[model samples]
Target: MPVLRAPEVRRPGRGDPAVGHRQAAPPPDARAVRRRRGPDGRRAMSEIVFLFPGQGAQHPGMARELFGREPVFTEILEEFFELLDGEGKRLRDDWLTDDPAVPLDEGRRAQPLLFILGYALARTLETRGVRPGVLLGHSIGELAAAAFAGVFDLPAAARLMEARSLALDGSPSGGMLAVGATPEELTRFVDPPGRPGGVVVGAVNAPRQTVLAGPEPRLGEVERALEDAGTPGRRVPALQAFHSPAMAEAAEVFTAAFAKEELRRPSLRIQSTRTARAVRPDEATDPGFWAGQVAGAVLFWPALEALLAEGDFTLVEVGPGRRLSTPARRHPAVRSGRSTVIPMLPSTAEGTWEFWTAALDALDALP
Candidate 1:
C-alpha cells in the first residue's frame, strides 16, 4: 500500500500540547492534498476516523449530566438501553447515576458501558452528517466497531458483550500495570522464559508506553522494580489481567459462545488493534480473532501508525476519556496542523452543550 502523509505545519505556540509531537514535513506529492476538491468546490470529509477506546477510560457518573444537555445523545442512549435486558439496565443505571451499588469499574460493567456510550456517540455524530471513513478499536472496543460497521446486528453484539464479559469477569482475577519504558527495555520483564505464567506485555500503547498484565504478585514485582530503576509504572484500574495467558481459559469459553452469533460482511473499513492494521472485512468477524484478542497483545501503536500514515485523518475519540487521543497527539508521525486528535466526551465534558459545541468546532471535520 502507498503511504499518504499530511503536510507538516508549525505547531501551535507554547502551552499548546501539539508542540511536543515530531511531525514529518510532507514531500512534493503531498501538495495535491490541499487542492483536492469536490464538484461543488467544497472540501470532502473522506478521511475522518472514529477511534473507540476500551477499558480503564470510563469516569464516575460520566453520563449523569449528558441526558439533559444533548437530547440527541439521550435519544440514542435510551434506544440502546432498550435493547438490553435486566442486567444491562442495572449496569446502565450504575454507570449514569451519582453513586450506585454496582461499581462502573466492574469488569463486566465497564465493557458494555463503553460500548453503549461509544455507539451512542457514533449515532449522534451521524445525525450531524459526520460519518467515519474508518473505525479503529482497542481490545473489546472492536466489538462496537464491528457493530457500527454492520458486521453483526445490534442484538448479536449486545449478547456477545454479555457472554464475553461473564467469561472474563468470572475467570481467575489478575492485574495490569502501565510501564513508562520502551519495548526494548521491557524485554527483560516479559521475554524471559520459564517465569510464572501471568506476566507479559498486554498492550504496546506507544513507543515509550506499554501496559503489562499478569498475576498481581508478579505485576507488583515488575512495578516496584521499574520504580527502583527511576521509571515508575502506574497501576491500571482493572479487575482482571487481560491480553495475557491469564485470559486464555476465558477466551476459549468466549470463542465457543461467540461463534454461534451470525456475522455479515462489513459495510465500512475496520482497523483492528489485535493485528495493529487494517485487514479484510471477513477477518474482522472471525470467532477465533475475537477469541485471540482476549489473550493476545494489543498492537495499538502500530495500528495508530497505520491510521496516521493515511493523510488528512482527524482522530475523533468517540467514547469517555481522552486516553487514546493523548497518545495519538504525542505520536511522532502525527501532523497536528491537518490531522488532529479530538475527544467527543472528554473528562471535562460534564454533560454540557457548550463543551460539545466547542469540541465540534475543534473537530472541524466538515467544510
Candidate 2:
C-alpha cells in the first residue's frame, strides 16, 4: 500500500494577483473572522469520507472475522436478525457466522446480510477512531449508507432492506451483462431497430463499462450484437434485472413500503446515482429518488466525478467484494490521478481476518 501525504498548505506567492490583492486589503480585525483553533491552538483534524459498495460486491464470508473479534459486531448482527424477525423473516444464525457452504447468496439473505456486514465494518472503523466526513453508497449499498449517515435507525434500515429484498425475490429472472464500450455503443446494441425482445441499459459504470439487463433468453442476441460491433461483454450473476424498466414493479413495491416508514434527513452528504449530483440530506428521503433508483440508469461516472472535484480523496470500498472498486479504478476520472481506491475484501482467499486486516492497513495508510 502507498500512502500519499496532503500537500503542504502555504500562502500564495507574493507575485500572485490574489495574494497581492488580499495583502492590499485592510487586515481583518473581527474576532469572528479568526480561524477556530483547537485547545492546543492547532487546526481541527482533517476529514475522510467513505463510499459503500452495493449487492454485486457481496461474498460468502465477508466481515466474519470482525464478528469473532469484536462483541459489538456480534451484537449488531443479533439486532439485525431480530429486526428481520419482526418483519416475519428470520435470517439463519449460521449466516452471521459465515458458513462457507450455506446458500447465503440468494437475494433474500444476501441483501440484509450485506447491509449487516457493511454496518458492522463501519462500526468497527468508528471504534478505531475513523469517522467519515461524508458518505456515498452505490445502488443497494445506499441503504447501508443511509443508516450510517443517520438518515434512519439501523433496525429501520434492516426492516426496509428486508422488504426491498422480498419485493425483488424471483420477481423476474433476468441477467445483467457488462459491456466494454462507451454508453452509446451499449445503447446501440439495446435499441437496434426491430429488435425482438427488449433490453435496457442498467448502469453506465464508466467510459467503457455499461451493464445491460433484460430477459435471460434475449441476452444472447444482445451479446452477439455487441460482439459484432467490436464490444466485448460478459454476463454478471445478478438474479434480477436491477436498475432497468424490468424492475418497475419491484420499485413500486419498495416505494410503498418506504412510504410507511419515517425517514429523516441524513447527517452527512450523499450523492444520488439517479442525478449523478450531490443530494442534500432532505432530498435523500424523497420517495421519488428511491423509486427512480430502480428503473433509472445509475450515473456512477458523474457521481465519481463530483467526488473527485471536491479534491483528492482516498476511497475505500466497504462491502463484501471488490466489484465496485475494480470498475472505479478503471474509470477515467479515477485513473487520471485524483484519488486512491481500495477494497475491504481484497482477496478471494479463505481466511476473513487476513483479508480485513490487509484492507484496514491500506485504509490507514491513505493520506
Candidate 3:
C-alpha cells in the first residue's frame, strides 16, 4: 500500500472551522471498499468495526476544527444541537472554546458531546461511503452506535441523551477511577452485590485495566487503597458515579424521560459493551436496556473478545479520542496483525494536524 500525503491547506470563508489545516481526500464508497484485494488476494479489509468511545473521551475543542470543515459533520452536529435547543448551543460553544463554563467531565456535558461527536463521525463516514460491518461502544458511545445502526433516529437519540444528562444531574454525587489491575485483582475492592454506596467495578476495559465507580468518600478511599496495594489508579474525568448503584435513581428517571420514543431494529450489527455480546433483536428495542446502561457496568473487554473470536476486523475509533483504541491495540489479534486499529480523529485539542494525517491514512488503509 502506498502512503498518502495530506494536501495543501486551504483557508475557508467566514464562519468556517477550517483554519487552513491540511485536508484528506474523500474516502471511497462501500462497494469500492469491498471490492479491494490485498497482496495475498484476500480481502485487505474484510470487516470494519467502528468503536465509539464513551465518557472520559470528551475534551475542550473536540472536533472543533472539523465542525465547519467537514460538511456532513457540520450539518448533523448543527442539527443535533438544534434539537437540543439552548443546551445544545451551550455545548457547541463550550466545545469550540478553550474556556468552557461547564467542565466537559460533568455528565451533562460529557455524555451528549461524546455521543454527538461519535454520531456525527459515523454519519460522515457513511456519507463518504465508508460503512462499518459492526458497531461497538464503551458506555454512552453505545447510544451513538445504536443511533448509527438505526435503532433510533438521530432526533430520538438526541432526546434520549438529553434525558440521560438531566437524569444524571439528579443522581447522587460520585466519581470514577481507572485502576491498573484486572477485575479479578480488584474483586476485593468492589462492593458486594446489591450494595448501595461503596465502590464497584464500573468497567472491565482490558485484561489488566478496570474502572471503579462509587459515591464520594468511598470512591476516594478506594483510589487510596489501590495506590497502597501497589496498583495506582488514575481518575476518570467524570462527575457522576456511572455504572454503579448510585445511578439507580438516575437510570429510572432516564427510562421514564424517554418512555415514548420509538425504537427500531438495528439495520447493522451492534456489539454491546454493557452485555459484552451482540445485542439481540429484542434488546435493541428495549428502552430498559438502553436506559439501564447508565447504571450498568461496561463489559468492554469481553465485548472486544467476542468480536475478535468471530473474525479479524479493522477497528476504527470513530469518536474524538483514543480511549477505545489504546486498549484495543493491546488485544492479541491486533498485536499479531490479524486486525488493525484506526482512529478517525485526533485525541487532543492541539493535534488538529494529526487529525488530517490520521484520517487520510485510515482512508488509504481501508479495503
Model 3 worst lDDT run, 10 consecutive residues: 1-10
lDDT of 2 by residue, 50-140 (tens): 6776656666545654453455666676677777774422454545344433356556666677777777777767776767776667777
| Model 2: CA > 4 A from native | 1-46, 86-90, 93-105, 192-197, 228-230, 331-338, 365-367
The TM-score obtained by model 1 is 0.83
Best by TM-score: 3
Residue 141, candidate 3: how far off, in angstroms? Answer: 0.2
lDDT of 1 by residue, 1-367 (tens): 1212222322232122432322323221133334445688766544778888888887775644455445566765666666677876676677656565666666787888888778777876777788888998887777778888887777887778778877976667677889878878888777453244658889989888999888766777877878878888888878788888878878888888778988777788888888877857668668877767888888888898877777667678888777788888787645435555667664643433334445654544255
Global lDDT of each candidate? 0.71, 0.64, 0.81
Candidate 1 residues lying further than 4 Å off, grouped into runs, are: 1-46, 68-72, 191-196, 333-336, 348-352, 363-365
Against the hidden reference, what TM-scores do the models get? 0.83, 0.78, 0.89
Residue-level lDDT for 48 in candidate 1: 75
Question: Per-residue lDDT for 101 in model 1?
Answer: 69
Clash number for each model: 1, 0, 0
